[model samples]
Target: MSAPARRILLVKTALDGHWRGLSVVARALRDAGFHVIMGGMITGPEIVRAAIDEDVDLVGLNVGGHAAVVERIIAELRAARPELPIFAGGVLPPSTCRRLAELGVETYPPGSSLEQIVEAAQRLTGVEAGKA
Candidate 1:
């Protein structure tokens, strides 16, 4: 039998309400044959709850604020699910990207391609094309 589709949870870390980037990324992930859950602007607790409730295999964060805030959310997620893989993308400056990188969360800043993001998702989730 075929394996079930790998599920991804995409969330906005801040109340930015910017959907364009997330929309494009979601579409790409969907097209790549992953089940993506769009968790619109939510707090760290909400993100944690959704991550657990949805039983996602990977988490994609759309960051639009200080790196410290994202750090906290990442911490919360790690505490809840130590093995869950997490990645992020947004208007992150070089310094902020480095900060997230230090925390082990891959960052895809502006100008990152949808193909690249999709590849990261596959790698992070261990769901290669035609195999998920």
Candidate 2:
């Protein structure tokens, strides 16, 4: 029997309505054969709830706010699902990326390649790139 599909939840931490980046990443992940759930512009609690309810294998955050805000969301997600792998991408500064890395989230700032993002998703979700 074939293995079940891996699921990933994509969320925007800030209230920003820009969807171009998120859309592209989601499409790449979906094309890689993983189930991608887009959680648009939600709060930390909502993200945690959605992750738990959706039973997602990984969480991807589009961080467009201060590092502290993203940190808080990370904390919430960790509290709810400690083993859930989390990655982020957006307008992150060097310092913010460092902070998130310290918290164990892989950050993909502007100019990060789609291949790299896909590879990270594979690693994070424990699925082979094309097999997912």
Candidate 3:
């Protein structure tokens, strides 16, 4: 039997209700053999709790807020699970992307292709594409 798909937690870090970017990335990760858990518009504490409860291999944050909020979530996640791989995508400015990059969270801005994102998931989660 084939191995199980890697699990990914997809969360939005703000009250903003935009779902297009998250939806696309979640779909891409799923197509790449990741079982993505959608966490819509959650707070830092909520994200942390869900991350622990889900037992996912990767955490994908859909950030559409001030970098401070996103940073807080990153910090909390790091504190809770230092080894968990994280990547973010959304309406991020260049400066915000740089900030997140400094925190070891890969940022994918608007217009990032699904193929590239899927490839990134494989690299981040250590799950080879098309093997399962």
Alpha-carbon RMSD of each model: 0.9, 0.7, 1.1
Point out where model 1 deviates above 4 Å.
Answer: none
> On lDDT, who's better, 1 or 3?
1
Clashes of each: 0, 0, 0
Candidate 3: residue 46 lDDT (0-100): 92
Which clashing pairs does model 2 show?
none
Report the C-alpha lDDT of model 1 over 33-130, residue by residue, as the tens digit.
99999999999999999999999999999998888899999999999999999999998999998888899999999899988898898898897655
Task: List the global CA lDDT of all models.
Answer: 0.91, 0.93, 0.87
Top model number, TM-score: 2
Q: Give each model a TM-score.
A: 0.96, 0.98, 0.95
Taking the tens digit of each residue's C-alpha lDDT, what string does model 3 give over 22-126? 887888777767898998888899999999999988899888889999999999999999999999889899999999999988988988888888888888988
Which is the better candidate, 2 or 3, if ranked by TM-score? 2
Task: Identify the superior model by TM-score, candidate 1 or candidate 2.
Answer: 2
For candidate 2, lDDT tens digit of each residue in 1-132?
979889999999998888899989999989988999988999999999999999999999998889999999999999988999999999899999999989999999999999999999999988776877
What lDDT would candidate 1 get against the real structure?
Answer: 0.91
Q: Which stretches of candidate 2 lie over 4 Å from their true place?
A: none
